[model samples]
Target: MPRPLDRCHQHLLAALVVRLPPSLAALFFAALFLAFPALASAHEVGLSRGDFVVEGASVNGEITFAQRELATFLPGLDRDRDDTLSEKELTDAHDRIERAVIDRIQVLGDGSACPGRLLFALPVEGDGVTLKATFSCSAPPGEVRFEVGLIEDLAFNHRQLLRVGGGPRVSEALLYRKRKTLTAPIAAAVVARPSAPAASASLPSAPTPAPEESAPSTALDLFLMGIEHILLGIDHLVFLFGLVLLGGRLRAILLVVTAFTVAHSITLALATLGIWTPSPRLIEPAIALSIAYVGVENLYIKDAEGRWRITLPFGLIHGFGFAGALQEIGLPRAEVPKALLCFNLGVEAGQLAVLAVWLPLLAFARRRGWLTPRVVRLTSVLIVLAGVAWFVERVFGA
Candidate 1:
């Protein structure tokens, strides 16, 4: 009886040894290393705002950038080396800060450059500094172009939200390192357009060109933003990867994915629309805990039964994480629905794209007998460690 049981155990172990291609394991580990920073750094990106007002040929505006980011460009501002800028440090370095801001941001009127003059620099209530500047143009501006170069040499991802105002309407554009320039017709030009004649007026007039459309609803932009958010969010990606690593059939995979989709979508919309918002200090750590739970659970569960049950509730917590990012973009009230729809769709699209590639690779591994019990256990251990690290960092960092 002892010999028979030993033989049975050996057979079971052999069956679990899926002969996965060596390259696949290497690829997986490489990807994991690449994403480690995301798991470690809770605040992976910084956001700034630029508000521009165009009056005749002169332009004036305020640019608000996070002090942490500014420290990278102007290290002298952090005089005490305490990793934060003091009021006196900021005041003493006012000239250097002003010059840095002027060199990075530009406003062009018509074909000529509008030289910028820094008027004042002050620290905002939070971790931000506001710089006021005025622009002088050669002629009354018509088509205005805004360019931001603040991201150069920065270690982390940075975004600038630009709000341009002149006439009755205000238009917004999001700026990143790669796409730093935004061109729009000045609201002043739109206000200058002559009124259309009534049908009773006989003179044939050139069809009044429709008022230059305000930046068309940026649905595509919102979609891309969603994808970027997920990709940059290493913790989120790791959680998804843990789900995939568990190995499941198509039907089970779809069930789990659908549950996650529906669940996160609910809270994401609710929180973004100002329905109910949980504190980030709470939501972030909860998300990290969820990741750890999935990984640790994978070590014990031999089957995918009731996996969707885990995904559904955890998905709700992840939704709040997504909402925090979208809120930072400051979606306009009227564009909320469209932005919300596109952003959510984009996240789903990104999730599917990842699964589309990863699932097939995993399937091949499983068929080839690469996923041995030992391999699965090892992967789960790594995932759990990552989650714990993130949880500690986020909680203590908060």
Candidate 2:
């Protein structure tokens, strides 16, 4: 087994890899050139930011958010169908956009409703489409609660980082789908009343438990986000399917899966930690490339022998792909490590769930002699076709 495998690797290296079937190569190369533009964009994280100042019943703020995100809520804004919200398009739809923005985010002053109004909308660089707005309440708030409705409509993994300034130190929170409200306690100095100093001691104690509660909630939400991301990632799933579809010894599948997990985990941690990050444009096309590579590779190898080597490099790319999806590039440093850890864990759990169902079914088919070379060939061809289509879409669509 070892000798034959070694010879196969030698042959692969010598020929610079055997020529792919001519038909497959022709279609892939043709589409690749046509979709070359898509390599310009990478997967971005689902993140946004808002800075608010509270002063005596009035809260005014500016939020920098992903245009694509807002597009999810108001897709019609993409008028050109380019998957982007352009400046002209946004400016043209100013009234509708403004109303939509201010209406979705609510500000509550000391539990009293604060009416919100959009002041302006500006399209910024990258995915940032900025909105400046104000909210008015009956009285100055001792505590300000910001409720973001964006999360409910955006992707499950979306998080909005909020800065509420009425305190000695600005209070911030990362709000997700499950945790949409951020209650920022206004410092006594900012929202002053003469008796605040005397009552401050007790007031501080009341909100002290918040940090404790936040950690768990944040972790759980991120974990679920990771799961949703993996499950919804058609590209990632297709690649995974290519890896294990050949159904072989359980041990071999485990090894291949482990290799992929470790590689992606390393990159995921590194990218999330800001240690090393890859370009967004490079990631999506490369991911498509990985799927194509695997589909072609599976056409030759019947078993999982030496498959880890192939999965390893691509796994690293996959990690960047995962992080790229997070575009959490602007997320708080303090929360990143926790989010990375929990999200990675959730991804692994989701990966296992998928394998648990598929592997056994494949094993059952193998035992029944239902697994045949013809089926594998057809599946591989289909994977190759899908990879080509995705590569073109990501490039041209970007």
Candidate 3:
């Protein structure tokens, strides 16, 4: 028969591997709330006359995805399984789903002008995992327009442009007339251009006009955006939680947080500044594995042994992940340093904030001897289990 200690370890591990106790759940939810930040309005929708610019006439619209449909697609993603989507899951799922959006958008006239053959792939605002494109006749300038809603069969409408996945669906199939635009002088001029006598039209004009270029995204915004991103990032928070669980004293927690802060900041700067770059596909799974590693280390090691050893090294990897958030926002060269500093600062602020709340509690627990060998062992085992769960999910999620 297994020894009592062995049985205890196994049982605790099992619990953590599957799910945490209700008590831990409260802490986890609290951490989730503080860590990931979001605004009621998450996505930006508008038009730009000058290559991704904010034209005089800009329209901001929001898209909502069906929570029930996404739950069916990625089961684990449904955090509550309540047939509803929470903010965090919606944010986490943004990248994968946003890729399917159709960028085949065309702007017909100049500033304050009508648009022609407009096509856009818009993300479902709440769902985070769904996308849809609206293909409609060009609207003249100064027309009030609404989010055309999800288009079910973009393939039939713009078969040439619809290359990948099917976009989101509208509740019902309805054909609404496109908005009519009050053409600008430039538009009227183009329209009046004698249609180049049918005979002269023989020489096909440039097959398709060059697409308007994507506008530049700022580094400051990107950096702050990174802060906003990490705050909303679930996997990243999971990794930080593992770190907090290990450091039981205020001093130790400070040392660990500092070491992590310094180390990750270096790497984040290097990667974001283009001094270095790593594939996210590789970094993401590895990040999940890193969480598992610490959890496993916590289970067996019992305490941090030395200064600037494990924490700093692991912190370096975490910094890379932080840099990835910067990458997602696309920082500009002129703003590289500022973006790097602010982003790293935001990351450190987050780590410091977590330490502030957790360290004191841990210290009190230790002083009271509540962090007994049994409890420490249990905490370690549970952490390892959570790490393992993340590892499996990330690996298989591919």
Runs in model 1 deviating more than 4 A are 1-39, 42-47, 62-96, 117-133, 153-157, 167-172, 187-217, 329-331
Candidate 2 accuracy as lDDT: 0.70
lDDT score at residue 31, model 1, on the 0-100 scale: 44
Q: All models: lDDT?
A: 0.69, 0.70, 0.44
Decreasing TM-score order of the candidates: 1, 2, 3
Question: Listing every candidate in turn, what is its Cα RMSD in Å to the true structure after a full C-alpha superposition?
Answer: 11.8, 11.5, 13.5
**Per-residue lDDT over 292-368 for candidate 2, one digit per residue giving the tens place of the 0 to 100 score:** 88889889988997899889999999898787544433444655677678878989998999999989888887788
Question: For residues 1-398, what per-residue lDDT tens digits would candidate 1 score against the true structure?
Answer: 01233888767645544454565456445445633534444333455666666777777666766666677677667878765566567667767876777766777888689988766555553345666667778877877888877666455566666777774556677677787887767754533332222221122211112223545544576677677777777788889888878776678878888999999999989977878878667888898889889889999887566699989999999987787645543444555676679878888888888889989998888889887777788777778877776787667643
Q: Candidate 3, 259: how far from true, in Å? A: 1.7
**TM-score for each predicted model, relative to the true structure:** 0.73, 0.72, 0.51
Give lDDT tens digits, candidate 3, residues 89-167: 6556554334322222332323332232212222232222223222222332332222221233221221011111111
Residue 87's lDDT in candidate 1: 57
